[model samples]
Target chain A: MDNTESIYEKSVVPNTMGTKSFNIDNLFLVAFFGGVIPMVVLGAKNAKWLNISKKLIYMLIIFGAALLVTKLVFVAMITSGSLDLDNTTLNISYRVGSVLLFIAFKLVLNKAFHQHMVVCGKMEALLKPALIWIVVGIVVEFVLVVAVSM
Target chain B: MCEEQYANDRKMIEHYFSMDRYEDARPIIENLLLSDPQDPETLYLMGVVYLSREQYTEARELVQEALRNGYNPEYAFFFIGLTYQEQKMYAEAEDAYLRSLEINPNQANVNAAYGYLMLLTGHDEKAIKLLDEAIRIDPDDSAVNDYVYRFYLAKNDGSNQAQYLQRTMEIARNEQEKLINIAVYHLVKEDTKTAEEYLRQLYLLDPTNKHVLEVLEEINRTNHMLFLPNRLIDKIGGPAVFYIGFIILVLVLTWADINSIAIVILALYLITAGYTWLAPLLYRLFVKGKI
Candidate 1:
């Protein structure tokens, strides 16, 4: 009982409230990835598992385009010196691009495998990509948290 | 025998009315008015025509005539209220809306308008209750939902913020409008990254959007401030950091002293700015490539 209590005190007790010392801004960085990581993993995993190369490409392109645009916009805003704390356009773009990419990737991969390739027996050949995509999402989110908190 | 003709003309009158051809509907409605000058439906049509033509005074008169002639007056009352609202006569508008509610409480527009008036008059609690009812009755109405969302935001009631924002998002038609709510929610919740994502999407979707442009700039500045490196600033070295470099350059014209400080400061500034600029770029270029 003493050993168990000591372990608990050293480990879980400190974080019982699940609140971090990070300020509100840091909290935002964590939350931003909350939506992002899921989208990324789901997107990549679905593309691989479904064998939807075209759709994957579309997703990647949209994602890249969105990120690129956001980077430019952020730079411009900072230069101009009129940054709002509650700007929502960033989140919306990520979500929109993620969704469009998901649909496009899934459809294209399914079509490619089903139409041109000669898969004799598997109905679920693309599960690996889907699982990997989920992992990627988690990792991305973790990295974002670290970046903000660090 | 006259029933068939009455039905035919009523249908034609309604059909023309629905098509917004008020002038075309006039003859049919006028015949009905001639046959039964006290006809509520006929009076209502006449009022509508007058209302469409910006003849508010005449419309009010006709609508009142319809009410006195034993017309049900619910629709007429709604129009009268609308006229009063357009005229900016809040008191008269409120009275008409109250009269409308008395006849048919299910009319969500009346409820919403009444709530708006109450809000304007500083009866917040009552206005919110009425607006809540209005939303309940017409969940699909974007205008009413937006009003409620703004109300909660104004009150700084963070708890209900998400729910109202979600409603606004659901009803928003365009990507730009949808981004506004997403940004606000993430912003209030202090989720800057997600807020940034939404802002980015808006910028891409509509580069000319001033709102998105403003937010992008804001987040970028905050991100820079939050992530700035103390080491980079310190590299500027003691007294020379702010003034001595400039002073030495102006007074002594010593190239070495000026060059050293200038190089150090310039390098530090570039590295700081570069890191600020390149951090996301590097993330997107190398790390996010897989995603």
Candidate 2:
């Protein structure tokens, strides 16, 4: 066979050949249920699978710090009575904050995630790791909110 | 069975499959499976037979077995995904497609199938990306082009929708295919009058086609004044437009401090939602005699 024909005939590894990573939808679900920390952790794991862990981890740290600052300001506003303690407002703000964080994480990871999917068609389920991270994340969030509020 | 006989049977099975004659291939595949149950190729062929018969569970199991016995893992998983998709078990289908893609990311059809799954599951963003990738890899594939066309149609992206539709038409294998695509394009655009005209031409060309008749009936049903809500929703590009309008109306009312008016608007929104849902069911029941 000619070189071109030989190359064409050779079987390359399928896109599912690498370490399993979570898709964007799963990341969104993790973020929704577990909050930002778990979402970041899971995203970091996916980044690791895609061999871009350092980039994602660094971006996430910056995002986390920014989020902390925002939370502190939010709490300060509530304490100073600039913002009301209406449960609906508080709930909406928290959910919206989580969603925004999810969007930010998705923006950072989108290209890498697409590349990974294009290169390796299969992904691992995020459920087990998400459950663990969610518990830890919720606990941390609860503690942080209480501590900051005080 | 002797090696020569086995080889001949394999060729015959492949030929039958190419001819889309699964029934003709089944007995030979079954005999081969009986002779050597561990034979991965025979197992995979049997899976194909089961798939054609719509015995999805059986098809899936046989393909899994084939994969276990060292059949092509990527193709096997792709087949498994197809079985799941056919049964509308989308989650399972996604997993199988992922596995298949993991093994062979270059498979244009798998990418398109996965993209369509994403679309069905409301992941429009992901669907767009996958469908685009599928088209990039194999632009000539009419099905992939059709999917891209459908995705753009849903997004109400007129230019991209028209581009893909034209591409699909360009690749049409025959006049029948071109006519159907034109009819569908008009139907989705809610130009039912134009759609009906094309369907009539298609009907004249292929009189026994049940799909053409059903669509013609649908057009007839939607012409009634009672079906105006359905036609309006289709023209305005789906229920999402109404939802956005409703949200804006509520926001405006709240901003104006018109609480009573807001309540009335909410009632109106609910009534609109109910009518949109009910009108189609009513049409099916009254016009088609089925829901």
Candidate 3:
């Protein structure tokens, strides 16, 4: 018992109850509304206020490229007359492929971006938008599935 | 048994240890051991110091000796588990952890350590259950929050990862450690630029940290797009020729009533020739023998 007390006293335990906080840049919160247009508008409006790193831009590019490739491939197949399969199946395949690629891209980008946010002390600011984007992706997929079934 | 004198000695020993005055603590520990050679608590305390010193072999021997000397079995088992863990002996470590838990399941850091073991062994669900159990039992431990952060990071659960990392950063040991953690978090995600910012902060805090310097060097080495060949199209002069040929070929086929198969051959020839000639040159100039 005495040994335990001694050890406890010997350890400099950090105050785990420090006011839990994160950096909140309003410009970041506003930039995450929706759609490509809103994003461009946000960037244009907050060009000076925001600090967009090149790594994030690259992540966006890679993510966008994944979806873009699906379209490019679909267009190529149509132009080349390569599909003898059912049109519906091809359309479904393309759409599903695009959605899956987007999710894959989003997963990677989120991991990268969230880590960056954490390092920058913007962890709390990151979570809300990250959650929003994930929910939006899920809803979009669910709506697409429903539309297809109908 | 002079209980008050023992308590005073214990306080003095703790005072030295807390200040990281290991040199001062050692002589006192030696004196205590000489006086009461059978004291399990003294042996255990020495084992704890050895564990921190990373003398795993000596630590294991000392802790085992403490257990034999009738030390607190739970703590003895816990320290033994920790020694095994440091050595990456998962099976032995798990056995020790289970033994410790059997004695006292509520041992504060044990559940977290075992959860880490579970995670390493690919039982993520079990790991979470145990880790969550640890949190319920000891919510105030920043080390528990760190374990939670590692769990989220391993599972690629971004929101939780961010949340727990934030918690960790709040109570980190020092600016250097916090900066390193942040840098590592970003580095693992391959976000070198963001990682560099944290690493730069760490460098400012401790310029002698080789790990920070190495990561900075690695990021610099990998940012190869800075050296990519530019204006290759202008150098090749292929775009102008291709477009001019395209226009003439389109006019011939659509308006001049030329041989369709022959024009197709000519167009294909232009496309293939342009690629075959320029591709090797570009490859040699930009990509040959480079990682």
Report each candidate's C-alpha RMSD, comma-separated, in the order given. 25.5, 10.9, 17.1
lDDT of 1 by residue, B204-283 (tens): 87675665787787677556533445333335632113223433443343345566666666666556545643555554
Error of 2 at B148 (Å): 1.7
User: For each candidate, what's the DockQ?
Assistant: 0.01, 0.04, 0.03
User: Compared with the true structure, what per-residue lDDT tens digits does model 1 show for residues A1-150?
Assistant: 223112111111111111011111111222233344444444444344433456555666567456535644654564466665333454444544444444343344443333211112124333344345456755764565344434
Runs with alpha carbons beyond 4 Å of true place in candidate 1: A1-150, B122-124, B140-291
Q: Judge candidate 2 against the unseen true structure and give its global Cα lDDT, from 0 to 1.
A: 0.74
Once fitted onto the true fold, the runs of candidate 3 whose alpha carbons sit more than 4 angstroms away are A1-150, B1-38, B171-177, B197-291
TM-score of 3: 0.47
For model 2, how does the per-residue alpha-carbon lDDT over B76-130 read when each residue is reduced to its tens digit?
A: 8889988987766767788788888877788888888888766555455667778
lDDT of 3 by residue, A1-150 (tens): 222212111111222111112222222222222322222232222221222345655555555455545544555565567744555655444444433433333333443344334323233444455445546644654464454434
Give the distance in Å from residue B37's predicted Cα in candidate 2 to where it truly belongs. 6.1
Tens digits of per-residue lDDT, candidate 2, A1-150, equal: 123122112122223223346866546657667767787777776766655558567877677567656766687778778887765556445555565667666666665555444333457877788899999998988888777777
Deviation from truth (RMSD, Å), model 1: 25.5
TM-score per candidate for chain A alone: 0.39, 0.72, 0.31
Best by TM-score: 3
